[model samples]
Target: MTKRAKNTPRWTAGMACGLAIGIGLGIVLDNIVLGIALALCLGVALAYALPSKDTQA
Candidate 1:
């Protein structure tokens, strides 16, 4: 298995997901830009707030 980088934070996946959600929300809400921005911030925040899923042995 690939090892995670020591200094890198696992925010990419979270951010991507947030962005995707934001895009959809924006489309539905008629505010793509705001949706993306808000979602991105929330996503990054959640990424930091949540515990890592992978554990090192």
Candidate 2:
């Protein structure tokens, strides 16, 4: 199996997901601050929760 490079950047997807959820919540709830805060927390949580491909071996 091919191993992932150790230094591969993985934050993009988390950031994008966070931004989408934040924007959606912000628009729906009419609370930009709450949405942003939630997004930031979620993105950080997700980033840490996700495992890098290198560890799959």
Candidate 3:
């Protein structure tokens, strides 16, 4: 089998958490549009900012 850069799926843990929290925050803040939009950005940034088990090929 060929070695891959990342063994994990595309959705990182941080992204998942961000989206989950985003939904809750969106409901609480009553701004789902903004919440989800911001969450996407937060997710991406957090995914990179936070460390994970994925490694280079």
Best by TM-score: 2
Candidate 3 per-residue lDDT over residues 1-57, each given as its tens digit? 997554443457768877887777888999999789878877777777665554542
RMSD of each: 6.7, 5.7, 5.6
Each prediction's total of clashing residue pairs, residues at least 3 apart in sequence or on different chains, is 0, 0, 0
Writing each residue's lDDT as its tens digit, candidate 2 over 1-57 gives 997656443576776777788778987999999899888877766665666666667
**Candidates 1 and 2: which is better by lDDT?**
2
> Scored by CA lDDT, what does every candidate get?
0.73, 0.74, 0.73
Score candidate 2 by TM-score against the native: 0.67
> What TM-score do all the candidates reach, one by one?
0.59, 0.67, 0.63
Model 3 segments more than 4 A misplaced = 1-10, 54-57
The parts of candidate 2 lying over 4 Å away from their true place are 1-9
Please list all clashing residue pairs in model 3, or write none if there are none. none
